[model samples]
Target: MDYPPDRDSWFAPLSLDLILKVLNVTFFHPFIAWIIPLSFRAQTMHWDAPPMLVSIAWAACLTLAWIAGVVNHRLAYGLPRHVDLSDEVIVITGGASGLGLLIAEVYGMRGASVAVLDVRDMENGEARGVTFYKCDVGDKDQVARVAAQIERDLGPPTILINNAAIVNGKPLLDLDLAAIDRAISTNLLGAFYTLKAFLPSITSAPDGGTIVTMSSVLGHLGAAHLTDYCAAKAALTALHKSLEAELRISHPRVRAVLVEPGQLSTPLFHGVRSPNAFLAPVVEPVDVCRAVVAAIDAGRGAHVATPFYARCAPWYNVLPAGLQVVARRLAGVDFAMRSFRGRLPVGENGERTE
Candidate 1:
């Protein structure tokens, strides 16, 4: 299905994130930094000259920072395992649409054995190589049966992507028991069920495997209307951390990647407004899919956050309660979901039916 246009106005087109992306490949780059110093020296400038000295310092700082990033990754994620697309079987939950569908389609087209498990049918029908299985990941019995089927149909899965998620944009007081249960079960327990069913196959793979957990920034900053969703996502982040620590000692070859993206422009979050357009422009599924694909292809663990705000969201948690409350008010976190219309089934007239 075709995605809606960005529709952002001219000024909305510019963001701090866009500027940072440009700088990363230019002025802030080590190569670019060194080039400035070399160009200054080519003019026969003295070593002690202000421009030359400043350029050298800048280059040194950039290089050191780059080195530190490498060191940080080594310490945090350890080493990468080997992955061959031809031999790796991938299983993605909620592979019917949005981000999960994108990842499944890419892997399928690239010749990896792919299995898509979702209660809904493939949104755009079957892709070239993706095999669809109708399974609600929240149900352990169904997940177990599908796992066995996948194993028999296409060897053992070497990569698992836990991307299924559902959101009910109602206040805690307004949500019914069934709605709360559905949100928690699908968003949190589904991950646990999938992991329990697939970890054995992932660990048993000869070349090891990777696990991708789809989380959200809401997990870090709870909002008014999303109490249950926030709680579930927060638990997922903790689960990822604990699992990573445990696997580091027992199955070092298995990698874990955590994706925490802000408001995405998908059917899942149809009418929700962004708190700030320039600061938190809704992320596209393709942008996020690229990061996930890269992490899986490299066989390394990573924490993927889009837009500048998401990368800095951790700092907000350290702020005082009063300040956090003020920030939430200013950012409209509580009010953003006021008009939310999720991806419930719709008829041809573009009106929701369920």
Candidate 2:
């Protein structure tokens, strides 16, 4: 099958997600389920008739399932804390552009204190409430110094978005040690550094804080040319789980959010293409930002995965090794990066930030 390059295709808007969205509001919704049975009754159909009985059963099942989902989340993640946007001081790494920038801008417009930490300046210049902090999260010293400055400048951060990431887009053997180190430090260790530097302030704050990790589904499904990227992301997910477990016993108030999204329409993965656009469509930066904002504003812990298939990616690990190989081939997992032409590295200045 020929996957068209990023163009205004006639079928561009058609995707598995679009189909599901339509179904959720109609067939899968509890309200719609009840409406079906009510419509049959309005037609003067017998109560025991097949359509009425089936619709009634469907409505009951959907309602019960909805209730069970709410119960499950409450038991697993605990109750949501209060979120007052006015009191929030958010710190987003890699917020100069892409998904991180979108998030920072949204919170900034809402009148919250927003600090954007990046090696480069803001790609679109400055937003209303967002203050750009020129710092490389990959450097522990830079992270520490910036943390102190942020405290003095805009109060201590009550939320940390660990969104800083870099991809060399190379195989393990082909990548030089220096490139590997940069990727590991920025993608994996950067999160640890930020948490260590900021968690103290977060714990001390009366409102507590939320830590957001922008992970990837490729973490679970290690790609052909993304060895370093996969390893770092895999570790990130593990870190999120371990930290959440520790917080439950110790802090209990701080929330941890792990976001595992598929390919996104960002310059970072510029030339890469999804194997199947319908089943595994490229996510929009805005979509990921919206989900993260909802989690933070709700003051709750969440494991968010986008484009539908990302949520199912974890189950891939349970398959037989042979089947895994076959699935990878069918999904074109390893081959997806064959045509990779990633974004060029940006410097400390605004130049070459793209």
Candidate 3:
């Protein structure tokens, strides 16, 4: 299937992310920061010299900040259980296409027992270690049946990735009841059904298991013409948080990973445009997949955000209402979907594509 072309200009790729990545390695990195002080000392600059003193102070601050980050991570997430990919049985929803499919294919190629539960057939046909189960996640009965089959075929699931979602880029008033139902059912409610079906096996597993929830930045920032989609995604974020809280209290061994990405260059948002390519550039599926895979491999509960802005998306909600309005206007979140045609063209049938 043909997807949207990049249609980006030469400088579109230069984003704050690029600048940060460069700085992280060169200056911001604690190791690199210390190197400057060492180099200054090697040059025999006096310890009290202005440049030497400044370099030493900078290195000290960077080192302290780096140590604090390590401490924060340890306190926040605790220890990570060792993960052996060969022993994992992973199940991905909406694995027929898009980000879900990318992850399934990668894990399949790596020899993990992967089960893809989707209403449609696998988009790229079957892969090495991946099994396709034709089931709609929005339907609890189907999810249960498929869960049983997966247990019988691949052993009890050790990982669950809740990646199924649909988008209807229409204003609240413009959307019909059916559209709203479809959005909430497949996006928010599907996660609940999947968790209910799989969490038991996960919590009971020898090494426990990981639960990954795929949400969006739009969930935190409501956008015009995407009321239903935004609301459903917002609920997903809440569900992930609440589930994480409950699991930490009751099922401490089971890990919960929340993934919130900005616009992806996928069929799910086919015609949707990024208002500012340099600021909120369309995210690539591989980057998101890599982050998810790393989090799962590390066997730790993680909050993964793609690109750069998504990591700071929650701060938008903290701004005053008037400032929030101004921020939305500057970001063009409201009008980003003005030309959204989604996966389906003007008149084509809309099959699930997440």
Candidate 4:
């Protein structure tokens, strides 16, 4: 489905994220920081001058911070595993559309064996090196059957992306049991089923594997009119953390990446409004995919958070209760879904209409 661009003012492009991106490369970078002092010296500035001293101190601080970050990552995730796409078989749930589809197509083009398991057909028909298997991740039996077929057809899986999800933008009182069940099963239990079915192969693979879980920032902060969706996403974050802990101890080579992104500009979130465009601009799916692909290609475990606000999710939980309420109100957390018109309406059999 094609989604039209959101209407915005000329300044819509000027976001906190854009400002930070510029600062990261020009001001915060170690190389750039050191260049300032070197340029000052080239201009015949005395070594003890205030400007020279400040520049040198700034460069040293930035360089040390960069080294500390590298050391922290090494201590936390250990060494990176090797990834050779040609020899890996990847399975992506909900690869028929959205972010999942983007990742599948990328790996397919790169000569990896990609199997997409979705209840719906592929949105763009056939893709090179990608085979579609119609299977609802919510159903354990269907997933089991598809797992066998994928193993037989494409060889053992070395990468699994648990990206299947469904959102019901309704208040708790308004949601039916069936809708609630579908949301939890698809968004939460679906990850468990996929991991159980494919983890063995991934763990046993000679090159190990990477497990990428697609979660959301909403998982950290609950929103109104999205009770079930929020609950399921929250559980996914917990699930990823626990699974990552176990994998690190028993299977150090297996990398587990947790992706918690802000609102995305996808058909899944069609008419949903952004509460604060400047502070919380809707992220493009391509940007999230770029981070994911980079992590997988580098064969490392990562926490991929998109948009600057997403990285601040953990901090939100530490705010006082009263302040949390104020933050919610300021962010319009509950009100943003009032105009939500998801991808399409659900059909009689629970499948979404194209």
TM-score (C-alpha, index-matched) for candidate 1: 0.95
Which candidate number has the best TM-score? 4
Evaluated with lDDT, which candidate comes out highest?
Answer: 4
In candidate 3 the C-alpha lDDT for residue 86 amounts to 94
The stretch of ten residues in a row with the least summed lDDT in candidate 2 is 1-10
Which residue pairs in candidate 1 collide? none
lDDT accuracy of residue 151 in candidate 1 = 95
Residue range with the least summed lDDT across 10 consecutive positions in model 3: 345-354
Off by over 4 Å in 2: 1-11, 348-354
- Candidate 2, residues 186-230, lDDT tens digits: the string is 999999999999999888788778999989998898898899999
lDDT score, residue 211, model 4?
Answer: 98
Per-residue alpha-carbon lDDT of model 4 for 17-85, expressed as tens digits?
999999999999999999998999999999999999999999999999999999998887778999999
Better of 1 and 4 by lDDT: 4
Cα deviation of 201, candidate 3, in Å: 0.4
Off by over 4 Å in 1: 1-11, 345-353
Over 1-354, each residue of candidate 3 has an lDDT whose tens digit, in order, gives 445455553235678778888999988988988888789889988899999899889989999999998889766676787688899999999998899999999999998999998776777887889999988788899899999999999999999999988888877888889778878888988999999999999999888789999999889887888888888899999999988898888877888889999998777887777888788888888989999999898898888887788989889889899998898889898888887777642222235344
> lDDT value for candidate 3?
0.86
Clashing pairs in 2: none
Give Cα distance to truth, residue 215, candidate 4, Å.
0.5
Model 1, span 1-354: residue lDDT tens: 333534453125777788889999999999999999899888999999998999999999999999999999999998888889999999999998999999999999999999999878888988989999988887789899999999999999999999988888888889999888878988999999999999998998888999999999989988888999999999999999999899999999999999999988777877777878777788888989999999999989999999778888989989999999999898888898987777675333424466
